[model samples]
Target: MLVHKRVVRLNEKPRIRYGPMLIRDQERIANLNYIYNCNDIEALWMLRMKRAPFARLVQTFRSRGLLQDSIHTSVEEQVAMFLHVVGHNQRLRVVHNTFRRSMETISRYFKQVLYVVGELKGEMFKSPTGRTPTKIRTSPRWYPYFKINNIL
Candidate 1:
């Protein structure tokens, strides 16, 4: 029996489409608008934060020059990409689909926002005084049981 050989064709090249991609950017903006402007409930479901805090974060990123808009993606999109990945414990591929961004784009923005959040830690948190609060210290039920310094 003669063996059949598979023929390889080299004449046809793959076509790269640019028009839909440009349109996708426009759609991305619309999606972002819905996420931020719609309501706090949707924002909470997506970003794990309310609308006010999400807007404040984007504003802070802009005001401090911590992050800037790229030619195609805005700071808001970048932050949303980061938050969606982190807040929901999602992988890069999942966020890529949600934001219509490449994995590299999602990862890059994630890193940038993570660094900026680290920088904000000092302002966002205060050191504990290490002393029991007056309420707990003075309460008869919780005094010695919850005492920080005078535990018997």
Candidate 2:
């Protein structure tokens, strides 16, 4: 049987440099700006939810013992990572690059947020009361149709 051997390099550290900037520094700067300076429209596009809604979700989960801020990652950042994964159907590597987090960190928090969100599915998807709005019922075009169907 043939055996495969790996060679270890001595006195060498992984080098990640882009021109004059370091990769880690670039990622940190990008993540910081994206997370903090994003407008509501950008936030909605990125997360598939508005800022207020996302904040509400984070607050609810925090209050329910589902999520908390760790030493390195905050609750908001965790939720954003979760959204970036689910909303965009992105892989962990992409999330790592976008969020400036390690793959392990991205995977861990992704699973955690996913579990908590799944547990809170009932509240998240609560059924409507099936009540029609009065404005819609009273509309000229809708009134005749609704009256014919006895819907109103």
Candidate 3:
């Protein structure tokens, strides 16, 4: 009797193609048109500088264990959601529509994100090393008094 063994080979390298699709081409054209035709400085400012607060909040949340890299939502999306809610002061439904998320999904994301932010606040701000300055209390006798008729 003769026995034969089967050997398996794996592809070590894979090839990838890099190019723009039809949809991407159209989007690029539209973006260029907007840049050329739109004179809205406020819109430009909004696109660039408006996300600072959200970025800070997202950083805080990431620092805490409540947020992890394994989550499906990108940090950018979370930050955008946060900014949309804060800048517009909008309701959850509005935020959901703005972020192009379902209301239930948006609610869940906001709930988790806010919970993480709160945890971060407690962990960071509760200590003196945080941004908040230490509170100081003055003695009653040393408190500054206004002089109405030169009376303490």
Best by TM-score: 1
- Name the weakest run of 10 consecutive residues (lDDT summed) in model 3: 1-10
lDDT of prediction 1: 0.84
lDDT per residue as tens, model 2, 35-103: 646888988789888888888888998998889999878889899999988899999999898887889
After superposing candidate 2, which stretches have Cα over 4 Å from the reference?
1-26, 127-152
- Model 1: what TM-score? 0.70
Superposed on all Cα atoms, the candidates' RMSDs to the truth, in angstroms, are: 5.5, 7.1, 15.7
**For residues 46-91, could you state the per-residue lDDT of candidate 3 as single tens digits?**
3333334445655766765566543545654555555456556779
Worst 10 residues of 2 by lDDT: 1-10
lDDT of 1 by residue, 80-144 (tens): 88888889999999888878888888888899999999999998679988778899888999987
Looking at model 2, residue 36 earns an lDDT score of 49
Order the numbered candidates by lDDT, best leading. Answer: 1, 2, 3
Q: By lDDT, who's the top model here? A: 1
Clashing pairs for model 3 are: none
Better lDDT candidate (1, 3) = 1
Comparing 2 with 3 on TM-score, the higher-scoring candidate is 2
